[model samples]
Target chain A: MQSDLKRIVSKLHSGMRIAVPVDYAGVSMALTRPMIEAGLRDLDLVCVPTGGLQVDMLVGAGCVRSVETSAVSLGEAGGAPRFNAAVKEGSIKVIDATCPAVHAGLIAAQKGSPFLPLRGLIGTDVLANRPDWKVIDNPLSDQKDPVVLIPAIHPDVAIFHAPMADRHGNVWIGRRRELAPMAYAARETYVTVDRIVEGNLLADEMTGAGVLPALYVSAVAEAPKGAWPYGLWGEYPADVDELKRYAAAARTQEGFDAYMSETAQQGEPA
Target chain B: MSNVLPREILITTIARLLEGVRHVAVGASSPMPAAGAMLRRALDENERTVRLSILGSVEHNFFTNGSCELFDSAGQGRIDAFFLGGGQIDGQANVNLVGVGDYPQVKVRWPGSFGSAYLYFVVPKVILFREEHTPRVMVEKVDFVSAPGVSDPEVYRPGGPVALLTGKGLFSFDKTRPGFTLESTHEGESLASIREATGFAFEHADSVPETPAPDAATLELLRTRVLDELEETYPAFAADWRRDLAALSVPA
Candidate 1:
C-alpha cells in the first residue's frame, strides 16, 4: 500500500523492534525523523550504527530504549554526541555486536533458522555480554574447533530510503543487496524513495537485477531528497556541510532539540 | 628537511610494514592506515597489483554484498592485511573494544566492536594501530577481551597480529614468542617515556633504533596522491592533518 509520512509514523508504536540499513547503504534520515518526532519511544533499534546522522538523530530524540548494532558514529564528521551521551547516562541498552554477528543473525532469520553458526567470535567479549549466544564444538568439523552461534534476529519492521521504486513497488536497490536479506528477516518492509519511476523497475534490463520485488515491500512512500545529508550511492553524494553542522549542533540536548525542531519545520509540506 | 609531522612518520612506517602484501583493507575511521595503504598502492608500478578495499569509499571499495561481504572475503583468504585498534590492548595483544570497568555496568562506553573479534582471526596481517599509547589504553589486561591476540595451538587460525604501531613507538608481535617486543621508538620518544606510558610489560632490545621519518620522495607522494585519494573517504581527517602539516612547516 502507498502511504504518507504521517501514516508511516502512525504505524510505529512503543517497543517495536525496527531495523534500518547501515550508513553506507544511503538510508534517508527523513524516513526516521517523523517517527522520532511523533514521540515513538522505547524502541528496540537494530542496524550497523553509522554514527553521526541517522542513529544519533533517533537516540538524541530519546526514541531509542535499546540499540543492537556494531557501532554508531559520524565517520569523518566526528563523534556521535547524543548517542554517546545516552549510553553514558544509562538510558539505553547498547547491544555491543560485531558486524558479522549482525549479518549472521539477520541471515538466520532470513533462512528461517533458529540460529546461525559463525566464525571468529570464539574468544571475544562480544560473546560474554550476549547470554543468548553459545559457543559449541563445530560438529561438522573433522577436528575439535569451537564456533560462536548467534540467535536469529527478526525485526518487526525494516525501513530504509532507496534511489528509486517503480509504481509497481520494485525497488532498484542496485549493489545495496543487504536490503533483500533485511526485508526477508523482518515481518514487513517499508520504504521511502527519491522518486517513483513510470514503468516496472524489473522490466528494464539495467535495473532488473537490482530490483527488490513488491513481494517483500509492504509500503512505499515518495520522499524526494530522502537520503539527504546521507548520500544515495550513484544518485548523489553525502552533504558534508550539513553533516558537519549536525555534529556541531547536536553536541548538547538543547542544541539537538532546536536543530530537530528547525529541520522538522523546514521538512514540513507547505 | 628534518621537520616532519608525526602522522607522516606513522604513514611512512605503516607503508613500509605493508610491503609485499597483495591486498590491504582498511576499516572506517582509520585515515592514517587508509592513507598508508593507498601510498603502498601508488608506489607499485604495476597497475592493479595492490588492491585496497577501504570501507566507506566508493572508489576504493568493491564489495557488492555490503559489510558482510568483507567478513566473507576475509574467511575465504582474499584480504592480505587489515587494521584494528582497541580501547584497551594488553601485552599479549588481546584487544578490548567493548567497554571498560565492567560488563553491562561499564565506566566507559566505546562504540561497540564492529569486526575486530572476527577479522583478527581471519586476516593474516592484522596490524594493531593506536595513536594513544598511555597506560589507560595500553593496559595490563583488558577488562573484557574483544579479540584474543593469541589463539590455541590447535585452532584453525590463519591470521594474527604482525606488529603494533603507537604514536610513541613501534612494537613487533613475534608469533613464536606470542608477546609484544619493543622494536623501535619514535624520533623524540624515549624508552623511559614508552615504559612509563605503557601499562603492560613487554620485552625490548638493548639498543632500539629510531623509526625513520618519511623520505622526501615519500612525503611528496603522500602530500599529493595519497592525501588527494584519502579526501574521498576521510575528508575531515585529510583536511585536518594537512592543516597540521602546514602549521608545522611554518618558520618560527
Candidate 2:
C-alpha cells in the first residue's frame, strides 16, 4: 500500500483511464511521466492545449486518446484542436471539460440550492448539452420552475498538482484557481506537491487555497519538479530533453520496460 | 501608484478611438474603457440605444444576479471591440502559441491565449494590445501562428486585426505588411524606439504622427465614470485595480 510511485503505477492492469486537467507547457511532465513508467500508458488524458503548456507531453506520453475542445485555437493548425501526428488512435472518445461542472451545477439547479458542490463529474463535458450547456430547467415558468437535470462526469480519477498542502489534506493553490470544482468531483483524487507546508506557516490569506480535506486525496507525493518537467510558477520549463527522452521510450510495453531497465541500471528504484 | 485616475492623455486617446461608434465591447480586467463608455453614454455617445456590451464582465454588478459563473471570456463577444495579446507575432501577422523552439519547444512558454483562441475569429474589430513591445514579443515569424490575419478567405475566417495598441505607438497592419504596418507613435516615442522594441524589423509609413493627448471632456468623463463610479461600485475589483497599479503588469 505504501509503495513508491513506480510500484503503485507499474502494477495497474489495463481498461483504466486517468484525467489530467493541467495548464499548458510541459510542466506536468514529471507528475505525469511516473504514471507511464509505473505502467499506465494507455490513459485517456483530457488536455488544455494552448492552455499555455503541455500539448507535446500528453501526445508523447501516448496517453491522450482524444482532445476536448469547444472551439479551436487560432494557431498554425488554424487552432484546430487535435492529437499529435504520432498519436493516430481512432478509438478514443472526446468529451467536453466543463461537462462535469455543468452536471454538478444542474444538480444544484434542480435542488433549488445555492451550489450542490457534489463529488460527481465537474470537469469533462458529459453534462454540457443543449443551449443550457449543462443545466436543464423548465423555461416554462418565470416565477417558479420545477427542476433541472445535469449529467454526471464519470472519469475514474483526477490528478491535482498544487503549490502547497497540509498533512490534513487542506490544499492551497497560493492564488485563485479554476479547477477546484472538477478536482472535488472526481471519484478519487491524487495530489502532488513541491512541499507540504505546516498549518502555522500558512497565513490566513493563504489557507483554503487548495481543495482537499485530507480524506479526498488518495495519493500525495512530494514531486518537487513534478509539474515539470513542465513549468512550475517560479521555476523553469520542464527539461524538454528528458521529456523527449521519455516519449521515445514509453510508446510500447517493451519501450517502457527498456526505459525502466535503463533507469534502474542507473540506481533508480525499480 | 494606486489605480490613479486615468491620465487625461490616455483617456482622450481611447475616447477618440471609440468615437463615432454606436456599439462597443470591453473584456475582463479592462475597466478604464468601460468607465469611459459610461461617461460617453452620459454624454450621449449612443443617444438612445445602449452601445457597449461589456462581456467577460468581471465587474461584480453583472455577475452576482445570475450566480454569474460563465466559463471563459470568448463567448461574450456581442460588443464591438475585443482585445488580444501576442507572445510571438511574426512578419506574416501570425501569432504563435505552438512550441517555443524550432522543432519542438521554445525557451519562453506563454500561458496560451485563454479565449484569444476564438475571439480572434469571431469578434469584428479586434484590437491587439500589449505592454511589452520587444523583439521576442513582436517578432518576424511566431514559432506557432496561434491565430493569423484571415487571408485564406475561401476556407478559414479569422476576424482579422483592426489596430494594435502598444506603450510606444499605434499600428494598423496592411494586408501585405508582415505583422502590422506602423501607423503612429506616442508623443515621446520615436521610430527608432519602436524599431528597437520590435523583434522582427518592421516597415513604417514615411510620416508617423504623434497621438493627441485626451481631450478635457474625455478626461473628466473617464475620471467620473471609470475611476469614480465604476471602481467605487465594484468593491471586489478594488483589489485588482490596486494590484494593476502596483505591478503595472496590465493596463489599469
Candidate 3:
C-alpha cells in the first residue's frame, strides 16, 4: 500500500493539471501531503466546482501555479486566508469559474466533447473575463437566445479520499457521485481509502451501485483518517477547532510556515 | 418583542419572503438564510411541505450526485428560490462575489462566484442578502458582475433578483425598471437614514412603513425549532444565537 502511494506520488510532475474533489466529498490530505513533500511546483489545480483547506494549503506552500475554481472558502471557519492572500499578491493565476461551468467542463471532457453549452453568464464580468468561453446563439431557438460554451477540462490526475475500497481496487463512493466524473475525465485516478475490504465491491448489488470500477483507478492506498481536519461523509465530523486554528495561523506567511513546521514535526497520522 | 435579536428579525423577514416557494436552496456559509428556509418549512400550514435543500448539510441536502446536481436542478427550474450574498452589490443589483477594484488584479479579493452566475438566471426568486448595509457593500456599481441582476431582452433568463434584504431595510427589484424600490425599513431605520447609508439612488415612498416584527409564536418557533434545525449545519451560529437570546431575556 505504501509502495503504491509512493509510485503514484512519483508520477506527479510540475506543470501538471490535477483535478481534486470538493471539500465535503473527501479531500485527500494523505495524497496532498506527499505531493507537497515532493516539492512539486507550477501545478494547475482544478477544484471540481469549489475548494477549501486543501487548495489553501497548497497555495500557501507555493505548490500551485494556478487554480481553476468556482470558490475557495473555509465555510464556517471563515475566508481561506492563504488563497485570498495569494490572489491579492498575484502569486497564482485564478481561472475564476462558476460551479456549473466547472462541472460542465469536466462533463465535456468525460464525453470527449470539445465544449458544453450552459445557460447564464451573459453580460457578466465572469463571461467578460474568460476569452476562452464563447457566446453562441442557441441553434434550436428561432429567436435570439444565447448560451455560454465552456471548453473541456482534461486533467493529468484526479485524486481523493474515500471510505473504502475492495481488494480489486474498486472504490465505493456511495452518494458522492462527483468523483466518478473526475476519474473519468482525468488520465489517471489515485485514491486513498480508510479501509480495504476483502470482497468484490462490484459483485454485491447494494455496493455495486456506488462502486467506481478499477479500470479508472490506477492505484489505491489504505490511509486511515486521510481527510483529517476535513471530515468524510459518515466517517467523522470536521474538527472545527483545528480548522479555526489553521485559519488564524495561515493569515500571515510567518504563521503559516510555523503551523506547517509544527504539523510536520507532529507527523499527523494517516 | 423588544428582546428580538437582529438575526431573528432577518430570519423572519426571509421566511416571509420565502412564502409559497415549493423548494428553496441555501448555499454554504449562509446560516441566516438556512435558518430562514427552515423557518419557512416549519411555518408551512399547507398539506404540501416546503422542500429545503441547505448545501453542506448531510441531513438537509437530498442531492446524491454531488454539487453539480444543484446547478442541474436549478437549470431545469426545479429550484424555486436561492440566496446570493456578495462582497459588493450595486444599485442595478449586479453582485460582485469576485473582488473589489479590478478584474484579475483586484485590491480586495473575495471568494469567487459559486453558483450565482447561473443560479441567479435560473432560480425564480434570487434574494440578495447582505448583513451589512453601507456604501462600501451597497455600491453604485459593482467592480465585477459575478452574476447580473437583469439581462437583455434576448437573453434566455427566467430568473433574476426579486428582492434585496439588508440589516437596515428590504427592497424589491423591478426587472422592467432594472432598479430597486425600497419596500420597508427595519425597526430602527427610516427612509432618510437608509438614503444616507446607501451608495446608490433607489425609489422609495414618501412614508415607508417599518418592517413588521415576528409575533410571539414565530419568535418561539425561531428560538426553538429553527435554531434546533440550524444546529446541524451551523453549530457556532446556533450556539451564539442561543447565547444572545439568553442575554436578551435577562432583566435590563
Candidate 4:
C-alpha cells in the first residue's frame, strides 16, 4: 500500500496526463479548481472516457489533452454525455477506450495470448480498421497469431472515487465496479475514498478485485464528494442542472472567474 | 394527434427513419441516446430494433456486475443512438474538445473530447443532438477539428452522421453541398434568434420550416411505457431528477 495522498500535492508536475473516470467529477473538480484559479503550471491534462459528466470542466479549466474513444462516438458530441468543442478541437484524440473490456482485450492482444477475449464492444466499430487499431502477430506466442492490438494507455496518473481505501493505498470500488481496466491501463493510480479502513482487505471482498494495489498507486487522498460536479452513488453529487448553469455562465472568461470565486468557498454541502 | 406536442413526435420521426436498421450499437457514457433507443422499444417497434450500450463513468449510473464487465443493459447489446456533446462545432460539424497540441505540452489545454472522434465514424444514422445553441458553440471553421464531419465523410472509414438536432430545431448537410445547411427551426424561435446564437454563418437556401409540436398520445405513451420503466430501473436517480424537475416547474 502507498502513503498518504498529501504527498501528491508536493509531487504535482507540469506535464502529467491524469486519466480518470469522469463520473468522479468531484475529486477532480476539488483538485483542479485551485489550479485553474491560481493559473498554476501544474495539473496539466485530463483525459476522460467518453460520456463523462464534467467534460466541460476539464475543457473550461483548459488542462486537457486528447481523449481516447471508439470511432462510433464521433457524430453525436453535443447531447447527454456530450464532448464539448474545447476538448474536441484536437485536445480530443481517439483510441479504443470505449470500455475497460476493450482495454483488456487490447492488453491481451499486446501480450499475444489468444483471442482478445472481451465482452463489450463485441459488435461496435471499435473493431474497425481505423488508424487507432493494429492487428499484430503474437510476439509472446510460438504460433503466428494475429490479434487486434490496441496501444497501451500508459496514463501518467489515474485517479478514481471509491467507497473505501486503506492507508496503504488499497483502493476499493464498492458497488460501482466499472473502469478497473482503465485504472490498470494507467501507469500510476490515485484513489479518493469515502472511508479509510485500517487494515488491508482481500481482493475478492471488494469490487473489481481492488484493481489499484499499493504497489501501483502513488498516493491515496481522503476526499468526499470528490465526485462532485459529477456524482457518487448514494451520497451527494454535483447538481447536473447546476453544472448546466455553470456551463451557461462559463462561456466567457470574466464570467468564469466570477463563478469560480463564488463557488470555491462553497464546497459540496456536508 | 392533440395540440400538445410530445417528445414522441420527434423521437418517432427519427424512429421511422430507423426502419431499414438491422444491427444497432451504442457506446458508453450515452444515457439519453440509449434512452432514445429504448423509447423506440416503448413505441413497440420490436421487430426492427436497435441495441443500446454505454461507457461507464465515475459520476454516472453504476450498479455494475463486475469491473470492466459491461452493465446488463450493454451486455445485452442494448445500446444505440449515441448522446454526445461538444462546443465550437464547425461547418462540416467536425467536433473538438481536446486542446490543440502534441501529446505532452498543449498550449491551451481543455477537457479531452472522449468518444466523438471514434464514435462519429461508426454509429449508423447518428443524430448530432445538442440542447444548447450559442455563437461560440456553433461555429464557422472549428479551430480544432478532432472528429472530421461532412468535409471528410467519404474519407472516414465508418458510417457517419445522418441528422443534427438542437433545441432550436434541426440541421442537415446537402448531399451535394459543402457543409451544414439549415433545415428547420423550432416553433416560436426565429431565424434571427438562431443566427444571433450561432458562431458561424447561418446558411439557408430557403425559409426554414417550423418544428412539429409533440402530441398527447406520444407523451402519454412515454409516461406509461418509457418513464415508468426508467423509474423502476433507477429509483434513486429518478426520484432526484423528478424532484429537480418539479422545482424547475415551480413558478419563479
Which runs in model 2 stand beyond 4 Å of their true positions?
Answer: A1-270, B1-12, B19-77, B97-99, B156-158, B176-179, B201-203, B229-252
Q: How well does each candidate superpose onto the true structure, as a TM-score?
A: 0.93, 0.48, 0.97, 0.58
Q: How well does candidate 1 score on lDDT at residue B98?
A: 68
Q: Say which prediction, candidate 2 or candidate 4, comes out ahead on TM-score.
A: 4
Residues A1-270 of candidate 3: C-alpha lDDT, one tens digit per residue: 656667789989999999988889999987776788889999999999899899999999999999999889887788899999999989999999999999999999999999999999998888898999999999999988888999999999999999999989999999999889999999999999989999899999999999999999998898888898899998987888889999999999999989988998765554
lDDT of 2 at B176: 48
Per-residue lDDT over A97-179 for candidate 4, one digit per residue giving the tens place of the 0 to 100 score = 44443445434433544335322121232344245456565577676544444445455676666666776677766554444
TM-score of 4: 0.58
Docking class of 4: incorrect
* Runs off by more than 4 Å, candidate 1: A1-3, A49-52, A268-270, B1-3, B215-220, B235-252
lDDT per residue (tens digit) for residues B1-252 in model 2: 433333334445555555555565664445555654566565664455446555423332233111112222223434455566666666555665433664222343333334443445545667676656788778866665556655443322335577777767777766544357787787678998888888765667787887666556655555455556566434445555555445654664
lDDT of 3 by residue, B101-169 (tens): 877978888889998899999999999999899999999999999999898999989899999999999
Candidate 4 lDDT over residue span B167-220, tens digit each: 776777543455667777876677888888777664775678876654667556
By DockQ, the candidates rank as 3, 1, 4, 2
Model 4 misplacement above 4 A: A1-5, A13-17, A25-43, A50-156, A174-187, A198-200, A203-211, A240-269, B6-8, B20-35, B45-80, B83-112, B130-144, B150-156, B165-219, B227-252
| TM-score, first chain, each model | 0.95, 0.58, 0.97, 0.68
Comparing 3 and 4 by TM-score, which wins?
3
lDDT of 1 at A22: 78
**Residue-level error in angstroms, candidate 4, position B248:** 18
Candidate achieving higher lDDT, 3 or 4: 3
| Local lDDT at B136 for model 3 | 96
